[model samples]
Structures are given as structure tokens and as C-alpha cells.
Target: MTRPAHVLYVAWGFPPARGGGVYRALATSAAFADAGARVTVLTAAREAFERYTAVDAALEAHVHPEVSVRRLPFDWPAREPDRARWSAVRRAAPRVWWRVRKELDRVSFPEVGYGPWRRVLEAGARQVHADRAVDLVVATANPYVDLVAADVLHRDHGVPYVVDYRDAWQLDVFTGRRKHRRGSRVDRLEGRLMRDAREVWFVNEPIRAWHAEQHPAAAALMHVVANGYDPQFAPAPRLEAPDPARPLRFGYIGTMSRQVPLEAFRAGWAAAAARSAEVASATAHLWGHSSHYAVEHPGSSSIPVTPGTPGTPSALPTGGSGGGVVVHGPVSKTAVAEVYAQLDVLLLILGTGRYVTSGKVYEYLASALPVVSVHDPGNAATQVLVDYPLWFPARDLSAEAVATALVSAAAAARTADRATRQACADFALASSREAQLGQRVSALLDAAR
Candidate 1:
């Protein structure tokens, strides 16, 4: 009898680390296991999430019982800094010392904060391979250092490795800017990994296209494996009519980082409120982490902001004007459906550019609420939402444009016809992660054969 293919999957932000990438990582691992591959997940210790980011114990339930999970110690001084435990030299010149330490770490291995983990990971991969043959090495990245371990296994043991880039390493997704200088360590290291990888998966075509251009020789190996919504997290498509007495509640549920145009959203929301009474009375409820960095500083509530322009609506508790933008902060994975059920409309806010596509868009699409997109028209997310019925995209980043979109979207939500609702439900059911990942995982496993 033939044994199952042994797969070693490396993802630093695996389960319990309630970041945006966790869902994608979890889904990928589960897919491999469901495909009957003997999968072992190599990830950072769960304790790291407790100290650095919010933890969702609920996500653990989704993992396939047959999958083996091995957690390694991670030293994230940047995330969980301990001044109390600092060395004399570190305390004396903290900034200088930190910079030097970073340089040293990068020199040893090409990743930050995660560079030192290379030796441990390399050792772990070798041991896993020694115990039983590893047919394929799949490495997903944010801490792209995980790729190094895959590369090590491929070079040493001849195991074919797949590199999965949920986000780019050398390119800034928001600005479409190159982050590294020519011939830099990142450029050299990433080039090496791409050239040797059996296949490389990107979350979108634009990103894959960019990488293809960067590494012409590896272009043929590049594939688009999009980040998609888990059907289980989807709230039943909103069928009820919008309440007329209370203002429409437009909600956003996702992490708010520098990439998210919160200020621009605030301006647009205020302008929309002033222009339309329906919008004026509407409340924009912002949920999820204000910023990933906010976890390090627990006392912080909202992102810092400049005062709103005069004549705009009054500032809300969250820094935005119109008293419409309300920040609810982070919620557990299970509470997501409850939050979605309360919303009359969903706001899809994403960073600008071809490289930027927020994972939250899938959830927004699944919710079936009228969506107001506060993002660049050039954004890759536009491709996904363009065909989606009930999607109202902003004309531009200006407050006037966003306001216009929001007002129009609110009107649509108040009177969404049955056809529009059915279309949304159909679209969501078709775009689920299971539908997306099922064939891709099978193809990948077949390739391993």
C-alpha cells in the first residue's frame, strides 16, 4: 500500500496569532491535511501571540487532527521589549544597540527578528526529514526567513519546495515601491529562493506578475492562489430590510494599520454625512485591531490623528469626524459573525495600489451587505469586487469622492432588491476558500508526485 505524501509546511504566523495572515495560513495547512497529505506545521510558539498580538484559541479547532504541529521559540524583542531585562549595553544605548543587533541578525540570515531562527528551523527540517521522507517543503512567508529553511532542505535533501508569498518581501504593497537597493541581501536571497523553488504562489496575479518580471527565469513557476473567505465565518446574507427609524450602521471589521486610510475615511464619512441626511445619521462602526502595533501598547485605544477640518462633523470617540466612525477594537474569531449580523452596510477600506488587496474584501463580499470601497481604483481588490453586485467604489481618495460613494451605497442598502441579494449569495458561495484551495492543493500534491 502506498503511504501518504509527507509535507512540511512552515508558517511563522500560524494559529492563535490573530493577524490577517493567520486565516490564510490555517486554511492552507488544513487543505494539505484534508488532501490526505501527512503534514507537519513548523511555527512559532503560541506564547509569542500572547505577548505580541491577540490570540484566538478558537482557530485551533479548525486544524485537522492528523496534522502535526511543532512550535519553536521565537525572540521578538521588537514586539515584546523588556527594558527591565535589558543588558547594560542595551540600556545605555538602546537605539544604537538595537540597530547593530539588527544588522548582525540580518548578516547571519536574511530576515529581521526571525533571522536567528534559521539554525533551529534548519535543524528541525532535517530531523523531520530524517524520521520520515518529506516529499515536499512548503514555506509561507511574512517572516520570509521560513523560506530559508525550505531552501536548506531542498539543497541538502533534494526535497522540492514551494514558496508561498501571502505578502511581498522586497516590494511595498501600498506604494508599489521597491524596498531594497540593488544587490542587497534581500535581493540576493529572494532571487536565490525564487530561482530554486519548484513553484511560487502569490495571493494575486499582479503580485505574481511583478515577481515574474523580477525573476524572468522563474516566471513559469509562479501561480496565483488568492486569499479567500472561509464559508463558516460568513454571516447569513442580510435579507431583512434596513430599519428606517435608526440610521444605517456601516461597519468595517479588520486590522487598521498605516496602510488603511483611516484619515481619508474619516474625511469622506464627514463629507458624506453633511451631503445626505441618510448618511448624516448613519454610524460607521470600525472593528478589529486599530493597528497590529497597538498590541504592544495595550493602553492605546485609537490611532493618533490630526484634528479634523473645520465645518466637518464632530469628532467621534475614534478620531474620525461625523460621530459616525466608532472603533470597537479587536474581537475573537467567533464574534465575527455576531458583528456582521448587526451591520446594515459593509465598508471595504484597503491600501492604495495594484499590489494591495485586503483579505477582508472576501469577508465583506460574503456578508452580502452594500459595500462602500474607500480605496484606490487601481487597487487589485477592485478586480475582485468589480463584478460583485452592490459594490460601490469611491471615485478617488478625496473626501468628496468617498462621501459620494458612501451616500450612494447607503441608498442601495436601504432598498436592495431580491435579485441583488441572491447575486451576492451566489458570488460568496462560489468564492469560498474551500472552492479556491481544493483544486490548487490537489494540483500541488500531484506536482509532488
Candidate 2:
């Protein structure tokens, strides 16, 4: 009998770590296993997620039984002592110790929080390779330290590796700015990995194009592997329009990161109410962790904005003016479908950029709800949702433009028929993660041959 191709998958955020990139990481592992590869995943300990980032116990139920996950120690000395089991010194003065510890960690490895794990991960890869011949090593990055392990396995054991860059390491996606100086440690490391990698994968075309332009020699190896929505979270398409009498419910489910322009969204919602009767009664519900640390810790931070920025209306909600926008805290994955079912319009709020296509946008597409895009017109998501029939893009980031879009979207939500609903569902089905990753996995296997 012939042995199956052995794949060593490296990712820092896997199941239980409910971060945005977790879905991509989890799906990649399943795709490799589904393609008949013997897959093994190396990731940070579950405790690390519980102590720092929020955890989604629901995701564990979805992981394939064939895949083996190995967890290594990852102590986040930055976050305050939760129920985590760590040293008293680390628990007491995290702010003080983190600064000192982080500096030393960077000296050994270029990555900040994850740099110290370099030795353990490299050793883990070597150990996995020794147990059985590893035919391929696929590493996903945020820490980018995973590339070090991939490089080590390739150098020591002659295993070909792939770099799955969920996001760019040296390029800021939001601003299209260079994050590292030329010929820096990160620059040298990135160059080495790209040169050595068998393939380089990116989530979107713009990101791939940017990398290709930066490294012309490695451009041939670059491939676009988009992040598609998981079928489990999407509710059945709503064929009926929402009741005209009741207040329209606009929903957004994702992290409320610093990049999110909530002030503009709030301003727009208020403006829509003032301008249109159909929108006046509308309520926007934000359902997700405010920030990664918001759910687990106290004193969660928020971005402060000027009283009235251009395009931003001054009528504040309650604390400043009235009540309509509600911020619901994070919910479990099991409850995600129910949340979508309750909404009439989906608010697609995002940062401004040509390279920012968030994974949530795909899930929003799957919901089959009327979408009000509260973002810069130049965002990459506009490219994805251009053909989506239910989409109502804002003219600009200004409050008045967003308000107009919101009002239009509210009307669309109340008038959408069966045909419109089916079209949205069809759009989602076409970009299903199974279909997206299946093609990539098949291509990867063929390349390995």
C-alpha cells in the first residue's frame, strides 16, 4: 500500500481562537485533509486564546476528525492575569515585564509577541518530520514567525513549503504603506522565504498584485486564494421583505476594531432617520467583540473622534443626541445564524483601502440581506460586491451620503422578492469555501506531483 502525502500545517490562530483569520486557518487544514493528505497542525495552546483573545467552543465541533492538532505553549505576558495559570511576576506587572520581555524576544526572532516561540516551532517541525516524512509544509502568517519553521524544515529536511499569507507582513493593508524599512531583518526574512517557498498564497488579488510588484522574481509563484464564508453560519435566504411598520434592524457581526468608523455609521444612521420616515425608526445593532480584549478584560479601549468631522452629522445618540444604535456584545458561533435571521439590513462597515476585503463581507453576502456599505468607495470589498444585486454602496464616508445609502437599503430590504433573495443565495453559493479551497487544494496537489 502507498503512503498518503504528509503535510505539516503551521498556524498560530486555529479553532477556539475566534479571530478573523481563524476561519481561513481552520479551513486550510480541512481542505488539505479532504484532498487525501495526512495533515498535522501546529498552533498556540488553547489556554492562550482563553486568556487573551475570545474563544469559540462551537468551532471545535466543525474540525474534521482526521486532522491532528498539536498545541505548544504560548504565554501572552501582555494581557492582565485572567484565570490563566502563569507566574506571579507575569500576572502582577504585565505592562512592565512585557516591555522588557518583548525586546529580548525580538532580538531572537523578528516577530513581537510570537518571536520567542521560534525555537519551539522549528523543533516541533523537525520532530514531526522525523516521525514521518513530511512531503509538504504549509505555513500561515500574522506572526510571520511560522515562515521561520517552514524555512527550517525546508533547509534541514528538504521539504518543500508554501507560504499562506492571509495578510501582508510588510505592507499595511489599510494604508498601502510599507511597514518595515528596506534591508531590515523583516525584509531579509521575507525575501528569503519568498525565494525558497514553493508557492505563495494571498487572500485577494490586490494584495497578490502588490506583492508581485514588490518582488517581481517571485511573482510567478503568487496565487489568489480568497477567504469564502463557511456554510454553517449563513441562515436560509429570507424571501419576504421586512414589515414596514416595525423599526428596520441593521446588523453588523465582527470585531469593532480601531479601524472601524463607528462614529460615521452612528452619524449616518441618525441622518437617515431624520431624512426618511422609513429609516427614522431603524435600529443598527452591532454584534461582536468590541476589540480582541474587550470581552475578557475590563476597561476596553475605544477610538476618540472629533465632535463633527466632514460628512459626519453632529446629532449624537442618547449620550449626545438620541437612541437607535445598539452595541451588542459578542455572541457564540452557535448563535450567529440566529443573529442574521433577526436583521433586515446588513451594515458592511470597514476601513478605507484598496486592499481591505474582510472575511465578514463574504458572510454578509451569504446572509441575503440588503447591504449598506458604510466605507470608502475605493475599498476592495466594493470590487467583490459590485455585482451583488442587493448591495447599496455609500457615496462617500460623509454622514449625509451614508444616511442616503442606509435609507435606500432599508427600502430595498422591505421590497426584496423571492427572485432577489435567490440571486443573493446563488452569489454566495458560487464563492462557497468548499468550492474556493477545493480548486486551490487540487492545484496544490498537482503541483506537488
Number of the top-ranking candidate, with lDDT as the measure: 1
Error of 2 at 98 (Å): 4.9
TM-scores for every predicted model: 0.93, 0.91
CA shift of 359, model 1, Å: 0.7
Model 2's lDDT to the true fold? 0.81
Query: Which of the numbered candidates is closest to the native, going by highest TM-score?
Result: 1
| lDDT, residue 297, model 1 | 52
Per-residue alpha-carbon lDDT of candidate 2 for residues 242-312, written as tens digits (9 for 90 to 100): 77667677878788787888878878887888998877776666767767752444434243332211111
User: So what's the TM-score on candidate 1?
Assistant: 0.93
Give the true-structure RMSD of model 2: 5.3
Report backbone clashes per prediction: 0, 4
Clashes of 2: 4
TM-score of 2: 0.91
Give one digit per residue, the lDDT tens place, for model 1 in 370-405.
988999999999989998988999989999999999
lDDT of 1 at 303: 45
Cα deviation of 152 in candidate 2 (Å)?
Answer: 1.3
